[model samples]
Target: MFAGAVRVGTIDRVGIALSGLCVVHCLTSAIMLAVLASAGGILVDHRIHAIGLVLAIVLGMVALGRGIVEHGFMMPAAIGGLGLGVMAGALTLPHDSGEVVYTIVGVAILALGHDLNRRAVV
Candidate 1:
């Protein structure tokens, strides 16, 4: 019903959806990280975080795989979509003014990764 109410070809619905998704994404990421930190900091170890990073990247690629199978040779844009979300959360985590430099670097790397993924689509 809600989906049907959304008009096609109008930015109205898309903008609302994106905004809502972003709000939820931010809240969920914050809560998850907090829980991880409080519960013995599951992500504290550099080696474990490295593994998690690899897993996250793989999941993004898997999303692309699913998209490729569904679209059948169309632009597999899933990786960029996922990478953008990851970067968005990562950038906000530090919150400290001094971390702005690191956030900029993360965003730049994210853009580069997204661009590479998008370009590689066949």
Candidate 2:
């Protein structure tokens, strides 16, 4: 997909633009999830955790909106919703299990986001 030139229409151009924003936040969430795991707990830095939590919420909402706008459904919301579940699970884990779970879920979010962005309509 990265090998060819991007021939973008106006709507596609807008989608392509938004693709970056949501995906970018997804990436940021991944990184923050990693660091938040180390220092024993994310509560240690509520600010960073707060940022990731907010980003995850935003990405989930945007993905949901895109699915509704583009396809009259909520597939993006579903995918991002899974990410939200994972993130919440990670945050709530009693111990370091959060790190392990977050990593696995983060990878899924990254892959799902990529697939959603890559697929041609229908």
Best by lDDT: 2
Top candidate on TM-score is 2
TM-score of each: 0.32, 0.51
lDDT per residue as tens, model 2, 5-59: 3332233334335435544544555566567656334443445544655765664
Cα lDDT over the full model 1: 0.41
For model 1, residues 47-106, the per-residue Cα lDDT tens digits are: 443454454455445444443543344343443454445544554455432333343343
Off by over 4 Å in 1: 1-42, 72-122
Q: In candidate 2, how many clashes are counted? A: 0
lDDT of each: 0.41, 0.50
- In model 1, pairs of residues that clash are none
